[model samples]
Target: MSTSSHHRPRDLRLDFFRGLGMFIIFVAHVPENSWTLWIPARFGFSDATEIFVFCSGMASAIAFGAAFRRHGWWIGFARTAFRVWQVYWAHIALFMVTVALLLVFDRINPSVEYTERLYVIPFFEDTASAFLGLMTLTYVPNYFDILPMYLVILAMMPFVIALARISEAVALAGIGILWLFATSGYLNLPAEPWSDREWFFNPFAWQLVFFTGFAFMSGWLKPPPVNRWLIGLAIAILVVTVPFAHRWGWQNAEWIFEARDLVWGGLEKTDFGVLRYVHFLALAYVAWVAAGEGGRRLAGGGAWGRFVAITRKVGQQSLAIFLTGMVLAQVMGMVLDLIGRNMLTWALVNLSGFLILIATAYGVAWFKSQPWRKPSAAEASGSRSGAQGRAEPVSRRSELAAGE
Candidate 1:
């Protein structure tokens, strides 16, 4: 690959939106918050999960696809494999910590009802099987399923990249067919111990959104010029959908204008329902038009620029920040249960949690930026000798491309 290809600058828009999504995820994860009422999910068919998955797909393509194009298929495959391993370990570690937290909470207040709600009751009842299931990715608790789904998608990314290389249309067609089958509920991976249960975010279906981002980043799909009519149409749809947002605010709230099932299927998050997908597309179009060049320019300087910088850092080190957010959210939930839930408590917890998450992101960024110590002359000589002794040749380009 040419140096220019490898040196392409990152898109500020992606980083900004991804950082925004991270904040939204943190808020959404902590339930019973007044802020949760105002999350985009309350007004639309989709939530932060879509943004996270889609952006992740785009990021993966840019990072791994470049490697495949520059080095070789195997190198890219190795990179993808490493990512899957990283996510798998992260998920497991998060699970262990979460379990520990819940156990502690239970000991503090046995009647708090944290066990059954968090879906760790099985872990207490059947420790051996539950522990095994967790390790095998079958005992996924609520809010913990997203990473596993992402893991599956990243694991299959090498093949997706190769297929796109061959023919974008064919690759996308295959993905569409899989998505259609998944949506029809004919195809799904079953949760073993929980026989009737399926993965919360189905990979087969959600891959459509993921690969859509991948295709766009890989240059297989070119974004169309912002059209005024499309923006108007999107705005109109959002206005029409405002009534649907009421369901979130009030329990058993009747729709002001109900439509037939044939016109729009109900929102099914697992399968990425047709209505939700279309709603997301409409939202994306409107956002693109609204942001325009002003959004790009804002990244240069000002209050918005600093905001973007912080978010971009959070987005860059999303995994660590996300894990921290999940654990923190649970802690906040426990605090609320003990003290009681109210507007003041909600505001304090969320505001404090957001600050902590931002600090964690900055910490990761600072750590990453720290300079490494140079090896001593003797150590350098030994390293050179070891490299010479190795049979397989190592590519310096591949070494530089280790992490993205």
Candidate 2:
């Protein structure tokens, strides 16, 4: 790695985006109630998942950048593998706790076949498929695990980092081709196979966004000369696409939100649809511009910071907070089902889900700060990286056991 490869440690903009992504993820999944439904698609924006995936990719770049620079590629691989394992165990623990709670409640009083669809039936159906998936670290159908894509990005980090070093232009060109395929569904790529499974995200397609974020951190895609035209172009794209999206949903095939049926023509998450991609890219651009000017100030040292600080906390402890929110949401849905809430009631109750998310994030942040475990590897790496140089710091990779 070139000393020229050496750059700043942490980028506040990336943190801002991660926090923003978490907030969007919260809103998108909260529920379709009155408080939210009326918010309008334009305001509601693209599916938040795109931003999350992109940010994760950017994080991989930053995290793996240092490791690749210091240790060899093997160390980076070992560390990434460990992080993948961490995410998997975290996911499994969440699943077990959720099933136990639901089962305990159901045992208190018998329940129906569906009973909230807590776990995927197929996960237990065949030992071969399930075992293969687990061993390969593949996604478990349509639950809330983002680990699969993150892991894939981690695996690809060396390529991305090497490309970043070789030529920023070459890396960006590769990203462009991937984006075209993801957006248009043109090519049957390595990441998004023709399998009928519903992935949380297809890493092949998502790599475009992720690598783009990496480039951003690597100074390949710095905020374009901020001008009236650039801002105008971004806004125009959103204005034109928003209503069109309403007329024809991103994936007409995904009429019922069936993950397998979704077919995206653009940057959509359903298939990495185009509108979703552009919308998120636009938002990202805006964030970048704002961060460049000043930290995208959610708040300062006063009362406002105290308030926005909650969101920042959520951003900081994203993974733990995300898993907690998923479990809580599922539990809440089960409770609502038991109460026999009508559609209207169910929607209203969804707000509680968002509240639960914020509360969980805040709570988890507080808990992690206690004197038990040391600060997360990501956090510690972040602190050290910041001491290194000027550019923004991306998320850190998990540490690996030696001799992997």
Candidate 3:
């Protein structure tokens, strides 16, 4: 009943973990990068994608929920629509920019096959239809699919907010039904022009993770309590699933890997499969207990805190960070090929990408801080700005494309 509840201090936990996921995503995206062999996804049913989506959902609850509570459902829908507009354009821009980068790099060194590597050559071969699909969001290459899925999922916010009004069960039912239909393959968006292939990350199915985070953050679902037994169970689930999701330390046992599909079954990353969903919830719960709400355990005035501060900054500017990282991942892969992939070069490429991601975060923060407008004479001269002048914008984004 109160918008005030939706308004609260920034949650550092969301920012810190999201920042971690951003880095993991960069490492994973780079082709043939050995570092990817160690990322969380290699060891579990879910990976950085879950982190990105769930945190986004939590962030959206803050970003959009207040509008629904304070203004009206129509106004809330307007706000959500405006965000979808922004994300749609961001998707277009990222694809265009990336395609241009790939072409430039390929022109310099065709042997690397940069464009063909990502299947972007198809876009060039059929530029007219491809451009049409890009503009309409129908020709989503796998590398470019995440934002489109996010855009579609974000557009569903009005319905989620509306259903929450009737009852929490109704809200959950609405979410569950959508996810089920999508999982059954009855619902999906076309990702390419020539075939019936669906988007790499189907928004309807993915919305389950997105809205679960939304539900908890919006108080529609009670937060899970930390318990010793639950902790043990979560740990067991994570360890037991490693063999199924990945084949590590088992170089001679290829059959064990093949047998996994039958034993555990259907944990497809594409559909937001049931096991992926459960696995991520368990991972999130353990992280929640460890971070101790708002990530209070992560606070201090020393070097550890400094590292945490940098991570939170990255999380805060995720939209920009993600766009930059995605492009850099491709570039880094090309660079690795150019220099010859090795332990030394691999380390350098990975570290350099992280640095760039960090820089993007800080740069975005500087812009979002809006330093361009001239300061008042007193503020310009280093006097304390009045509280009203210093207050954060109420319209600040919540996370991902939902940055706050």
All candidates in order of TM-score, best leading: 3, 1, 2
The C-alpha lDDT values of all candidates are 0.78, 0.59, 0.85
Model 1 alpha-carbon miss at residue 12, Å: 1.0
**Candidate closest to the true structure, highest TM-score:** 3
| Candidate 2 C-alpha error for residue 330, in Å | 0.6
Error of 3 at 378 (Å): 6.4
Ten contiguous residues minimizing lDDT sum, candidate 2: 1-10
Backbone clash total, candidate 3: 6
Q: 117-229 in candidate 3: lDDT tens per residue? A: 89888787889998998898889999998999898999998988788888889989999999999988899989878778889999999999999888888888877667899
Displacement of residue 45 (Cα, Å) in model 3 is 0.6
Candidate 1 displacement at residue 70 in angstroms: 0.7
Candidate 1 Cα misplacement greater than 4 A, ranges: 1-10, 248-266, 374-404
TM-score of each: 0.86, 0.71, 0.90
